[model samples]
Target: MSITIDPVATAGLVSREVRDGSRDGTPTKIAVARRTYDAEQSDLWQAVTSPERIPRWFMPVSGDLSVGGRYQLEGNAGGLVERCDAPESFAVTWEFGGGVSWVEVSLTPADGGTTLELLHESPVDPDFWTQYGPGAVGVGWDLGLLGLGLHLATGATMDPKESEAWALSPEGVEFARHASAGWADAAIADGDDADAARAAGERTLAFYTTPAPTPEA
Candidate 1:
């Protein structure tokens, strides 16, 4: 099982789980985030759609913006757009490799801004859930959405710098800690052992919060 945590790149960002349940092919859920930008939808869409603007907010993205076109980020792998509707909704394969999952993004106009909704769906390893939890993926997406919002609003990019710093912040540490416990509960809900799931969650959080000792060797 692979476990990872990324840092937040923007301020005033919020994220929550919207969907988590069993499905026909894979068990998945939806996570949503809301951010208010001073700009309009047209500019927001460009930041999300245009390659030049992507690195400014999200990862470096390159691919055809049309439906069914393959896309890839420099170090983030590749996927094809399953669907696309200009300035509103778009779907893309969320697969990292080896038949993983797909994540879709839908944009809805809101009060003076836009609401970005993300749906990540695919098969999950029962063992993976028992060890880490949904936050491994969910939290990363949370950070991604935060980056996108900040980019559209301020025309900036925060990658390794913000990611690294966030991993150590008090609030960031607390977030990981609570998120770990929550995901462990979710794993148990999926039929994992209560004790084992909790242990795994605690262990994951410990690993994340633990820092390297000073250079003494």
Candidate 2:
């Protein structure tokens, strides 16, 4: 299930790379991305951390986001804000059932906009990786990143169901297709074979476009 995407084909609105020890202090590895938007830092930061702005772009997130404060995302899981440095960086305890991971989001001011960097790390589980591959995490991030972009540019949020459905649209498919290829290239840049990565990207796209099975035909 290891799918990869070609970042260059994505036109640099988003790009991915594998990095070392940011979430968990280990060398096992993590995937990272840097996305830049036209909005200023203040606007972007508020959109991400403000309750009023949460549901508009992303999900309804509730948490102090201050160090040591527990937070929950409405129907989603809850976790403590492991670290928080206003407008700059924050880390959260990514908990689900008995499993635990960490995710850190950081923002830095650039020439005209801000660079939003995200890092998520899970315990390198072979079984999980085998079933979902990189998209298991990458696809989720892609959604989150899109939320941020939509908020920055349009100052609006998308309906959850609509968003998911949109991901099946032609434009959405193209985005994912290019994104998957980009990730494949990233893995290849990290020493994997280019051809194999390309093939994985194709399989991943097929899975995304495939219709789910229903009961009673």
Candidate 3:
């Protein structure tokens, strides 16, 4: 099934920020994305933190979920919970492969719903940042936010197979383009060269929308 996504609406719903800092003397960059969901802070918190609910929108999670405890995402990253403040915010160590990063999620109440903010901080690897820009991580979170929105609105689990198909569909391509551009803008706002940021954005767009390479004959 083809999913019709509104690129403009999606773009409007998310706000991105890139912040530069240092971690243990290594340069680091934090990519932050915020969006409002049409649900109460409590409900949104449960949707994100509950292991049972996570697989519905994101991926299956296992392990201790409390503060100072470790958690793992099946076939994905695992981490230690650094902080947790119930229906409000949490921070974790996002360990993947041999690299480690940090992720924090915050929730704030709004007029009709809750504002969710995700912050991912990692040591800045020049090569990767130069090639993919913030969309490397930003776009992934953008898609997660999309899934969260759907779950909050419909209370139905999305078919993973269908969601994969949708990502390569025309609408998905457009959405990626918009999201990539948004990340580029955020990078530029964070003092990146505009030309380089736009170029990286194009690469990121291609990465997200392009089909995998076929085997050589």
Candidate 4:
């Protein structure tokens, strides 16, 4: 499907933040992203929580999907649902690559629509943070938010293959670069060195915008 969007404008719609905290006695870094969608609270809530609808914007997910139940996103993280409050908020453990993180999502009425806040908190990895900062996870969520917005506006289920292609397109590259810069600013606001954060953002921009190597014929 062809999509028309203002890459920088859409990237600006999200409010980003980086936070430092502790979880289970381990230092943690939090990436927070907020955006208001042009949908009613109930509709936005359904778009996010309903299994039948998730794949439309995100990815295929399976397994039990309730408090204490386990769920997995296709080719991505799987974890246990820790809490749920219908049409309002949910918290889940994000288990990936043998590391555990926490994700919380909350919805609120705002600007005649709904505002969604996504917070991803994970134990700090010095090596990873030095290389990518918050943009590592933040850019991915930014793309997810973009997909959800597009799905909400058009009521069309996104084609995963097409979505991947778009991410490599010029427009998508612009969006990724803009979003990476936003995350870098957020990191700097949270006490990261300005130059290092900017450098990390550059790396992140390249990471998301780089096309995969072609297979040898």
Candidate 5:
């Protein structure tokens, strides 16, 4: 299946900012992205929070899914649900590979549809940020949001193998390039050095577009 990159790139607004400290006393930074959906708030909420429907768009999720419960996304992060307010907002601790972060999703009724905002806050690792900037995570979420949009609009079910191939395709490269550039602009707006931000964005773009190394025989 083919996916259009432009609409996904232009469909949302993304921002980044640094925060003081997290629950664990680590310095943190946050990336926020918002996109409007043609679905109703309730429908959007259900699509996001429903474990049964998650795999249809995003990834397969399992585990207790409620306030204070733990949930895991297949081959991805797992965390405890911190808060849940039906059809409006939810917050969770996004734990992955022994590192903990926070993610929150909010839904607002807008223009007869729903506006979905995602906030992902993680402890600042100077090396990582310098090398990749927010595009590391922002582009990831952008892809997820794109998948969500496709699922909502046309009930699309992406084949996993095909999806992996698509990521390295020309269309995917374009999408990542645009997303990384936007993140570079956001970083500059957040007081980063313009040259540094642009350099980091270049690194991020290369990281996403380059093919992975093959295993030795």
Candidate 6:
């Protein structure tokens, strides 16, 4: 699929932060992604929280969507909604692949627009962290922010197949590279070994840009 996105500029739209954290005495890592969109706070909140509109930018999500309710994204994680504050913030559990993490999204009005902040907290898995660093989720959020931007600007629904195709496109690869690098820098700022963090970022870049293999007889 052809894309008009300027990989560098689009990738730069979001700011990233990495930090060491914990929950219930267990070690964890927090990845924060923030982006400001040229849209009203309420409209952006609607786009993110309204089930009918989520698929237009993110993935198709189904299930109960209120506090104490459950939600499942068509091909991604799902869990209970732990907290919700209209046009302000919401927190949810992110359960996938036998792992449970936490995600919180908050919106604030800023400079004639709205800024969205996504915070993901995951239990520290030494092996996985060694292999991928924070880019594991950081780059993914970057893409989501980019999609949200497009949706707000054009009100166009994303075609799942085309979205998948765009990820493997040249522009997508470049964007992933930029995001991965940005996360690596954030990791370094968070006191990670510079070389190790950068190497892990490369692994993440490869993970996103590499296509799956096809089985043949």
The candidate with the higher TM-score, 2 or 3, is: 3
CA error at residue 174 for candidate 3, angstroms:
0.6
Off by over 4 Å in 2: 1-11, 20-27, 75-77, 130-132, 206-208, 211-217
Per-residue lDDT of model 6, residues 1-217, tens digit only: 2246899999999999998999999999999999999999999999999999999888999999999999999989999999999989999999999999999999999997999999999999999999999999999889888888889998888777787788899899999999999999999999999999999999999999899898886
Please list the C-alpha lDDT of all candidates, in the order they appear: 0.64, 0.71, 0.91, 0.95, 0.82, 0.94
Q: In model 6, what are the clashing residue pairs, if there are any?
A: none
- At residue 53, give the lDDT of candidate 6: 97
RMSD list, candidates in order: 5.9, 5.0, 1.7, 0.9, 2.1, 1.1
Candidate 2 CA-lDDT value: 0.71
Q: What TM-score does prediction 5 earn?
A: 0.91
Per-residue lDDT tens digits for candidate 5, residues 1-217, read 4565563445334344433446567678888888888998888898999998888878999999999899999999999999999989999999988988899999999896899889889889999999988888888887788788878888777566676677788777777777788888888888889999899999988987788999999
Residue pairs with clashing backbones, model 4: none
TM-score of each: 0.71, 0.82, 0.95, 0.98, 0.91, 0.98
Error of 4 at 215 (Å): 3.7
Error of 2 at 195 (Å): 4.4
Give candidate 4's whole-model lDDT.
Answer: 0.95
Model 5 per-residue lDDT at 44 = 88
By lDDT, who's the top model here? 4
Q: Considering summed lDDT, which 10 consecutive residues are worst modelled in model 3?
A: 1-10
Q: Model 1 scores what on Cα lDDT?
A: 0.64
Q: Score candidate 5 by lDDT.
A: 0.82
Give one digit per residue, the lDDT tens place, for model 4 in 1-217.
Answer: 5668999999999999999989979999999999999899999999998899999999999998989999999999999999999989999999999999999999999987999999999999999999999999999999999999999999999999999999999999999999999999999999999999999999999999888899999
Instruction: Report the lDDT tens digits of candidate 3 across residue range 65-151.
Output: 998899999888999999999989999999998999999999999999999999999999999999999999899888889888888
* lDDT-best of 3 and 4: 4
